[model samples]
Target: MKYRYFLILFTFFTILGACNQPISQTSKASAKKVINAAPEKKIPIDTSKAFKFNDNWVVPKSSLDFNSLGDSQGDTLKLAVCGDFVYSPFGTIKDSSAFSSSLLKNFSIVTRTEKMDNGTFNFQILNHGSSKLIFFFDTDPEASRHSDIFKGEIYDEDVQFVNGIRIGMSFPNFYKTLFDSFPDDLTNNYTVVQIISCVDDIIQTYDFDAGKLKSVKFITDSYWKVDY
Candidate 1:
């Protein structure tokens, strides 16, 4: 009887040990639960208030003496009511002054128009980055290039002002010449201009060196419409 009791006790412990062995199922399930838990981004619901604006930066009387850095009154762009910052998206693969100018030349293809009701208007920003431009249109979709506006936005991939500020500067008339080179119909009621130049505002300045952006200034307190 003593032998049998010892045998039974040993068998019970062996079974208990087998049952207690660490199982792989529980650990894997716990790990998966932890791995799958993550949050998602929330986009805005209301962006119904959007409208487009024109630019009014004028050109110097003499194209030969025009200075991109200063001495540019660029008036036609102002008449269009633009004259601020704009956004441009790009990649690090392509960059240079002539290439950037070629990219700017293509900005005319990016045109968006929506019917408005009185003063109700709004616009939205697309993917952000440096690779695009904004020029004013001379309202004349027909006269090759109207005195109204002549502009578009595109990336230059060629010009860099240090710390990844790749861009090119142009007077309103420079855009006018580009627009005039085309043979499209321009009208007076709704014009086009190439004076729209901004990265995040109607102003021509950008401040990404900081956390948030700071807009550029043209004539005192004049700034582009802020959407954010």
Candidate 2:
């Protein structure tokens, strides 16, 4: 009888120990999971609104003199110049008048007109060489009213900008020539003036893609303040 009793006690204790072992292992596993768990991420707060502006924000005057830069070698590559044709900010043409009799002889020209809601007309000229030109003219019947060339685009491989910058030129080379010729002080200035000698009165901007010259533009000074 005592032997059977001792056997029963041993069996009970063994079962209890096995249960305790699992509890201990479970606790250890839970602790490891807690230790290895990743922390929560915190979102950053924007504090720009708290910053204040001071007089130091004023932009300094540019040191470079842009007036001295001359036009490109070929007359066609010059600002407002195309194949045997030249357009000046001061020069004007009457409605439906030919661009140039001399240029018409050498190149086929396609012209289109779009009347805007305002009393103005938008004229687009496409030359045989794929050069595109735009002109804006007031609709007044006054003889003094003439069309003014506002923009032009050149895609010809042979043509280049005043500083030898071309359509396919690498961005680094173009930027070097641009900054070297123009002042680096474009901090707060709205307009880049005098990009070429003949185009001093007009403001210009350059566009690039993947470090390559994409296009050049002549825009109004107020264009900089446009919201997009």
Candidate 3:
């Protein structure tokens, strides 16, 4: 009877040891996964409020000469509105009529017009090699009467900012350029930047991906400042 009791006690302890080993190993693996998991990013600034102007805040502009990119105004929306054309790198594109213009012969200019409750909306896509420029126009009779708002998205390197900023620039250089030109804490320590021009009533966002300037978006303030 004494020998049988000793054998039973040894078997029970051996089973307990085996069970505890897996538990210990599993806990270690879970801890390692937690450590290796990708960290979450902080919440971005409230862009809707950013679009609105504060009493103390003024619009930010570029530090370099507006003419550095050749055209004095560059490809600014303001120029497109007041001047009735976009001074694109490929050419000066005026309106949706560009589909049949010389632009189509040299490059592809895809255009589409849609009817809306407000009025007619026109969109143009200018394809140049691997890059492209997309433009939106409010072709409503009354809308165009007031201002020629040329909302554009640029994937090309040739679309220059009046402040001399360009697409495909290094992220550090883009940040530094904005930092030196703008007088605000908002432009500091950011790989991406958004500038709202109250006078122009336009919002421009510069984005960076993989440490390089990716794309630039130009939109009207009234279009984005809403409860979404």
Candidate structures ordered by lDDT, highest first: 3, 2, 1
lDDT at 169, model 2: 74
Error of 2 at 124 (Å): 4.8
RMSD per model, one decimal: 20.6, 18.2, 16.2
Name the top TM-score candidate.
3
TM-score of each: 0.24, 0.33, 0.40
Quote the positional error of residue 79 for candidate 3 in Å. Answer: 19
- Per model, how many backbone clashes are there? 74, 1, 0
Task: List runs of model 1 lying over 4 Å from the truth.
Answer: 34-155, 160-228
lDDT digits (tens) for residues 28-112 of candidate 2: 9999999889698844423331211122221111222222323434211222212111223213344436455323223344555
lDDT of 3 by residue, 1-228 (tens): 999999999999999989877557788999999988969885454333222222323222232112111121222212112111122322444565654553334446666665656666665656655545456655456542222234556566755554456778886566565433322443333455555442345545567776677887656644422110
- What is the C-alpha local distance difference test score of each model? 0.31, 0.42, 0.48
27-80 per-residue lDDT for model 1 (tens digits): 889998888886667443222221222332223222112213222243222222
Which pairs clash in model 2?
A: 171-211
Question: Candidate 1 vs candidate 2: which has greater lDDT?
Answer: 2
Better of 2 and 3 by TM-score: 3
